[model samples]
Target chain A: MKDRPLILVTNDDGITAPGLRALIEVMNELGDVFVVAPDSPQSGTGHAITSNATIYCTAITIDEGDQIEYSSSGTPVDCVKLAVNEILNRKPDICVSGINHGSNSSINVIYSGTMSAAVEAGIEGIPAIGFSLLDYDWEANFEATKKYVKKITQKVLDHGLPEGVVLNVNFPKLKEKDIKGIRICRQAKAYWEEDFDKRTNPNGKQYYWLSGKFVNKDKGQDTDEWALANGYVSLVPVMFDLTAHHAIQKLNSLGFNEK
Target chain B: MKDRPLILVTNDDGITAPGLRALIEVMNELGDVFVVAPDSPQSGTGHAITSNATIYCTAITIDEGDQIEYSSSGTPVDCVKLAVNEILNRKPDICVSGINHGSNSSINVIYSGTMSAAVEAGIEGIPAIGFSLLDYDWEANFEATKKYVKKITQKVLDHGLPEGVVLNVNFPKLKEKDIKGIRICRQAKAYWEEDFDKRTNPNGKQYYWLSGKFVNKDKGQDTDEWALANGYVSLVPVMFDLTAHHAIQKLNSLGFNEK
Candidate 1:
């Protein structure tokens, strides 16, 4: 690693979000931080990129900080792409996304814009991490998360992540003193049971709001859901290669390859 | 399976797209088809949901077919969710997305709206497949794709997909007579070498268009890239579990679990 590493910062909660501001503060203590994030909130925009629209990234100053920042007219993934390919003259030593207001544990990772940024960075061969808290309120306290966030980032910087892998770090809604140490975990077999909020407008037009209750069926203690429930900050090693390697042989036996 | 199976059809290219119409035509032959697709083109919208926007799905008739259709003001993933939860009264026998006007063979799966719908269906515990052709033209002939599409769908109907797995099938741009049979394959280690088209607007401001060249370095014949290049249909079984199972032990040994 360089004497002073270049750190790329981003979040789905937009550039002016309090969560991102808190992230920038801690990242400043670690390295030369440069934030390239979305101009507007982009929650649930998983792995999306701006191909149809013209991308515009402009330099912005939200607060007094040592870190430089740019707001882009795109999704969280687009910010990461812009950071890696256009904004940063050289490759960053590490990329960190979100001190997110909501949890991205278990099945929520598939719908998370925060983790999508981290995944995009990993796809570009950079060590990356996505951090989130259990609380979903805009006024949620971030004081406790900073301590462990710094610790986890330092640990990753000290020991580089594995090839094609990134970390999805999620915290329980607890005080710093109440929080347990970092715990390595797996993504639990969990899902959202959708119950859309169906409503009719004044014009008699029907619309729906996507709402769901998270259902965790896995009873394994070695999962992110369990760790967070037990007051420990869960760290799941995430990979982008979506191939179900175990099923390949079974598929071969199904006779598609033959004739 | 039911004698007349209830099939859920969807695509990222919108309800008016010829690719989707082609998909509906094939699905109608196999079962009772229901299409819930985007109202506009949503090519690069990978796994995105419409949580931030008011989702509107209105019943519409696109063409003459023994199928029902709904045009949704949402992304591809949202279409699948709506189909599974609200639009369809019962569980679908299988969810099929696309006859997409472009390739979703390798790394493009991460950015593909077509594959995202299939992945969403798989997440919802439905057997699903995404079909795409190598050609990018809007009016690309899907005539060559229908025969193999029917055969593969019938095969999948006969033998269901493994739990938590979905198929990503891509066809080479070829005539029906010139096309080869299906080849079960793995996702290739391929990526886009991004080169942004930096430009200046009439207002003297700078903007960028995200453009990139597809780069494939993997020489393995068992991969999707190799199969497509060799005039065969590539079918890669994809999973949504982002866990890097192999790296869990490595991360443990690196001592994140240690106090």
Candidate 2:
């Protein structure tokens, strides 16, 4: 393959995050890499873009690498948009985001900035993937995830993904040897049980911190949760289409127009 | 019915948008409304939350209505988080967002702050709906939409939505008489064809504005786009599960194994 694949790399963990550095290292081995990510940590900052304010992007050197890097004053989605629209001269063969510090399995995808970058690329007619690990530690080991990441990325490059679909890959935090291979799975039926910590501010006003414990109610062994818990890296092919097709038929039968 | 349903209302178009006002008026007839919305427009801001900066919120009197309003310095998702956690004493019976100025049909749901608010509430186990009009004008007619909004809201009050599912309701911008009826449909397979408008700043650097035309390639008549085009109010039951359950079997065949 004399024509090296062009890979656009980004992350929700900002440019300097250890997770991003790990991701960059992995992508460097695979293709002609280009890095465009937020200037600051943007965890939990889903698909946000800078609309009301002007965004500024600057080129910076991350290390002695052939890849071009830019730091942006925008969200993860913005970084993708900027890269595709302003930076990249041509559409990259594939767009890969994260190797994120935490998991974006199940419903967490809705609030994940890492996945949003990939989703944005998918929306733009590019094959994209978002990778995350179960551990939230800054020094979480990503060395173990490289082979699987490369395999999946190569597969995606070889066989283009279906339109509007992207892959969400989450790895369980374990030593490389302890990891049970990769399993393609569905997102688990799970939700956050919100426990708001309310406290009085020093000014005698009340404030609250949003906190929650994840509760996975679905017992399907074929789900991302099961895959991760069993030490398998989970790969869920996700689509941006949120429609419940089966429920539509049920709703149509409700005589919504009977009035 | 003196104990009116506790309805938490919000929007991506800011607390002062006409669309939010219309939603507030409709909810006022059904419940004791509590509005916690962003002080500024938060369009295109998916599920972002404020973590790096201290958020400021204050009770504000926008009009002479019994509905209580609070403006916050955060994203639409943050509004939901703040409202449910700090402002309201109890979980709302229903959380309604938008009456958005533009359509959140199809893949737009992924980038929509309007739908993100509803999805956020749904994640927290609240029955939620995000409403939008096909028109993108600030002064789009909400008169005809009110009837459908009320009808849908009433039905939701009567029949609770399924767990992990929310509704994305989009109304075709038509005259009251031109409107056909409401239809429950699946999300259309559509995407934005992004064409970045590149321009140079005074500093001689190039930047781009993200702009695009929406393209609906799906021929399915059972989609939200089709329903809206046929002069009907489209309601798509959306789920937070991003997993493609059907793909699991194919992945199982890949022969992944433990090291």
What level of docking quality does candidate 2 show? Answer: medium
Runs in model 2 deviating more than 4 A are: A197-207, B1-3, B203-205, B256-259
lDDT of 2 by residue, B1-259 (tens): 5488999999999999999999999999999999999999889998887755556678998988889999987789888988887778888999999999999998888789999999999988899999999988998889999998998998888787877789999999998899999888888888776666767899898666667788999899888999899898989999887776665665556444423
DockQ, all models? 0.77, 0.57
Clashes of each: 0, 0
Model 1 earns a TM-score of 0.98
Error of 2 at B12 (Å): 1.0
Q: Which pairs clash in the backbone of model 2?
A: none
The candidate that wins on DockQ is 1
lDDT of 1 by residue, B160-229 (tens): 9999999999999998777778888889988887888889999988898998888999999999999999
Q: Which stretches of candidate 1 lie over 4 Å from their true place?
A: A257-259, B257-259
Query: Root-mean-square deviation of each candidate, in angstroms?
Result: 1.4, 2.3
By lDDT, the best candidate is 1
**Root-mean-square deviation of Cα positions for candidate 1 versus the true structure, in angstroms:** 1.4
Q: How far is candidate 2 from the true structure (C-alpha RMSD, Å)?
A: 2.3
